[model samples]
Target: MQACANWIDGGPQPSRADQWLDVTNPATGAVIARVPLSTAEEVEQAVQSAERAFADWGCWPPVERARVMFRFQQVLRDHFDELARLIVEDNGKTLAEAKGSVQRGIEVVEFAAGIPSLGMGDVLKDIAPGVDCEMIRQPLGVVAGFTPFNFPVMVPLWMIPIALACGNTFVLKPSERAPLAGLRIAELFAECGAPPGTWNVLHGTARVAEQLMADPRIQAVSVVGSSPIA
Candidate 1:
């Protein structure tokens, strides 16, 4: 059942505040679990953690970050079954579709694991007299992502691993309709050697998503949804 009763952070009880949201299995329309809905204040705490993590995380060497991503990808594959189950239960997708969705998400980690290539630098040949020009890819401070219900695991992958590899810490806002799946990824990120505050998760609706985007702490925002919704 994933024990949505708690959110995963550096350890257990990842959420702050008294507000909570119930999770139902869209497939069967049964109450699956209860997830603590993080208030704006609580969300700020996560942003602070991620912001604090950025100073060092932004300086993390590409190869070192790649190592963590490697282990992360392997671990995700190790728990593929569990991840697939949650997707199917929460999304009401056929079990096979859920598994495929998770598989695609796992592949994103793999793609991101090649950080050296993914985090490429730019080169400029002789911008002036005997002066070599170049630009290095660096972290973009704290990035917040709002993942949609269509693909809980997949949407998060679109941001977290890539952003972390680029040395940017993350705050994830998963859809309230199917939120626990994003929280689960936070647990995996920690397990993957993502430093405390390097990644955080919160659940909510448009209000929460807007809160994330509007926060100055979040330097960048990735809103995932269909074109029509936008």
Candidate 2:
């Protein structure tokens, strides 16, 4: 069986974990691959990488950040069919459904690419006797995404692009049941020139999710899973 490991600091890192989770083809009931059941220490390492990257990434001008998203969107478009195939192979979804899932993700990347204009802040100058205030959307340091297996591509897409476009470094903990798609997408992000440590992935179960939720460094968390998982 093929084994998949986590993506950390812009590359795949073999897990130090002693345990693994089996990924099964839901339609055929056959085990396809094994993913690491990452330890808290391992998950924390990814978080630390994001934290370290945040100082620079979070300070980058919005236009510069949008440039990265532009390249990311193009790279994703170039691999549209390939990504859909990975989704079907990993999750046992029909090819059509997998393509739809991947397309939905692509749309989010498109929206993120426009963040320089769409996400701009506002200012009311001299509102009250020479006083002015500005409300700007700023990056929250070290954001984390916890996605489920069912919508592997769509769910992570909903979070990662926007977070990165808005200048936040991210740590993703994709569901262990369907880890391949996330790993593959992370590879695309790297190919598009996203800096190391700006985006990271760790594969594991609820234990790792809970650790992420409890960590102080994770300023924001997004979950698109079951009620229990949320």
Candidate 3:
């Protein structure tokens, strides 16, 4: 059994906790690894970095933003096997299901590159003489996403890249149970020219989620969890 890790700031680091949780291979019922239980403090650092990044990235040109998304789409497609293996190892899903989720995540990146159009605007009416009125869609600033274990790849796809494409920096609070898939997506973002602070991933339990939603710097949150979803 290896240690399931937490990635913070930019790279992997040891959990400060002496108390670690056993991550069993759900399919085999064997103790596959130990994942560090992250502290609330770590979560805050990741959020602060993302907020700082939002100041500049929010104003980045949409076409340039799309370029990053395009690079991510290619990287994920090329590394599909590694992604699927990690998903199956953590979540106990069948190989096919894992592959499907990766594919969908790729599609979301594709969607993001194209959704630049969402930011486009049309000048409706020209006022009298030289005066005119115009409107354009802009970024929503720093956004937060809380993803779930059931669909690790797909749920994050529904959140992170879209927020990035929309020109917002983000703090992604992925599920502790199956967080590696989310981490893999973060790597893709880094590869695609997403500046480190532009997209952040924090590993923890519910407290990590609360900190993100409660923070005044965060502009919005999209969470997917709970069976009935109240």
Candidates in order, TM-scores: namely 0.90, 0.96, 0.89
- What's the candidate order when arranged by decreasing TM-score? 2, 1, 3
Candidate 1: stretches off by over 4 Å: 1-9, 14-19, 226-230
Error of 1 at 47 (Å): 0.6
**Candidate 2 accuracy as TM-score:** 0.96
lDDT for model 2, please. 0.88
- In candidate 3, what are the lDDT values of residues 167-225, reduced to their tens digit? 88887777777777787778667767766678777766776677777889888888899
Model 1 Cα lDDT, one tens digit per residue, 1-230: 44452332365555565666678987678988766666777777777887778887888898899998899888888888888888887878888988898889888888888999878899999889999989887778998887888899988987788888888988877777787677777787787776788887766656667777778877888888854322
Better of 2 and 3 by TM-score: 2
Candidate 2 segments exceeding 4 Å error: none
lDDT of each: 0.78, 0.88, 0.78
Give the range of the ten consecutive residues with the poorest summed lDDT in model 2.
221-230
Decoy 1 TM-score against native: 0.90
